[model samples]
Target: MIDIPSMQRAGANAVKAIIDDVISEKLDVEKKFSSSKTAFRIADLGCSVGPNTFIAMQNIIDAVQQKYQSQGFASHMPEFQVFFNDHTSNDFNTLFASLPPERPYFATGVPGSFHGRLFPDFSLDFVHSSFALQWLSKVPEELLSKNSAAWNKGRVHYASAPDEVAQAYTVQFAKDITTFLEGRAKELVVGGLMVLNMPGIPNGNPHSSSVTGLSFDILGHCLVDMAKEGLISEVQVDSFNVPIYVASPKEMT
Candidate 1:
């Protein structure tokens, strides 16, 4: 059976090429990095409980080490300190327990939402988040209001919903991502590099027309069917939402 870790690894692996390329070209190790023994801090925002996080972090460390070696600074390799961040409700104990026994970096857990500030200014040298940014800080308030045109009645997601519903999601995504970027800007040191891997649709494609949307539509139909059979309340279905937004390329820009 495919588990959450497997799924996370699959998604993260898909972006390995992008991560390597970005690190090789964009990361400035020579000028920005201190030759002293200060630890190189890294944060994995929205990192869920699992082995996949360790693998992804290790890949980053390996790439950075290669860069340092290529630039003739292998002997001056800085110590790595990794922060695993997630919502307060996440199972941090399990995440910590699952760390690789012989790992190189010192690991720490940070509990908080990524949309807000979670680190001191100019503290982090590298930031990484994979398959996580598509999540909104919260469900769009417009969807829960009965008087709003975007009220997500009989649906748990904006996929296949009216344009107003989709628009509400778009607005929330913009706000949440802006806050996230602002917080990260304050946290990263000068010339610091960040890698974000998110799921997105191509330009000109409606979210409802994508495979993920169709799946959500089916889920909504199932929930409505269950409501009709008196297995669940209509109110429950009406108030439910997945709080996930699949952005288009344009929306991301």
Candidate 2:
């Protein structure tokens, strides 16, 4: 559920900040945008089914509404449209049901990695993603087929890991980043700003045995227990690490 007070403040402020940044300098995405009707096209990439998402969407709308109104652009009342997207597996039904009947915003499930063409060429004015995109996809089979010291080289239960497993995870994360940027470059119209806010390891660290601290170690232990129970295999447990990205922000940049 949407936290009433928190969202009313943070969500609202986040929307205002983005709009202000773009509209003020005519910077980022709003720079090249010239529209007669003022129909602004905005999108929230990786919008999941939740109150936070809804609240954020509303906040963005409110900010944009206030923006054009103040500019004497009120007469045209820039036609407004919002697109809420997530991976295809997202619970769109839940999102839509939570939405009001009037539907001030339009919502859709794009069902693909948000890093790519969620919209047509030069279509978006602003794009926002909160708390999504970190996971790499399922580990590849070839890497884990052998439960050996080579593939499953680091079989420690909790505290340690081998270098190769780390490499496999890192490689996938880089691929995800590249894919994401490639898609965004094509979809976002020049001047469109795509704000991606997600958790990352401090600085530009590749998530490593150095990072993840103890939490991931606990996760590894759980996996080992599961493997012993036959809930999974040594091969499965061999592939550790969150599928999500934990790389440094500079790397993402």
Find the candidate with the highest TM-score and give its number. 1
lDDT of 2 at 237: 66
Give the runs in model 1 whose Cα sits over 4 Å from its true position.
1-4
Q: Name the weakest run of 10 consecutive residues (lDDT summed) in model 2.
A: 150-159
Collision count for each candidate, in order = 0, 11
Candidate 2 residue lDDT tens string, 1-253: 2233453346445555765565545532223335433456777777777666666666666666566666655555555577888888898888878876665666655566665566777777677777666656555333554664436522422224565656665667787778877777777766666666555566744344434434566667777888889888877667553454456666676
Candidate 2 lDDT for residue 151: 62
Candidate 2 TM-score to native: 0.75
TM-scores for all candidates?
0.95, 0.75
Candidate 1 lDDT over 81-196, as tens digits, reads: 99999999999999988899999999999999999999999999889998889899999999999999999999999999999999999899999999999999999988888988
* Candidate 1: clashing residue pairs, number: 0
Cα deviation in Å at residue 153, candidate 1? 1.2
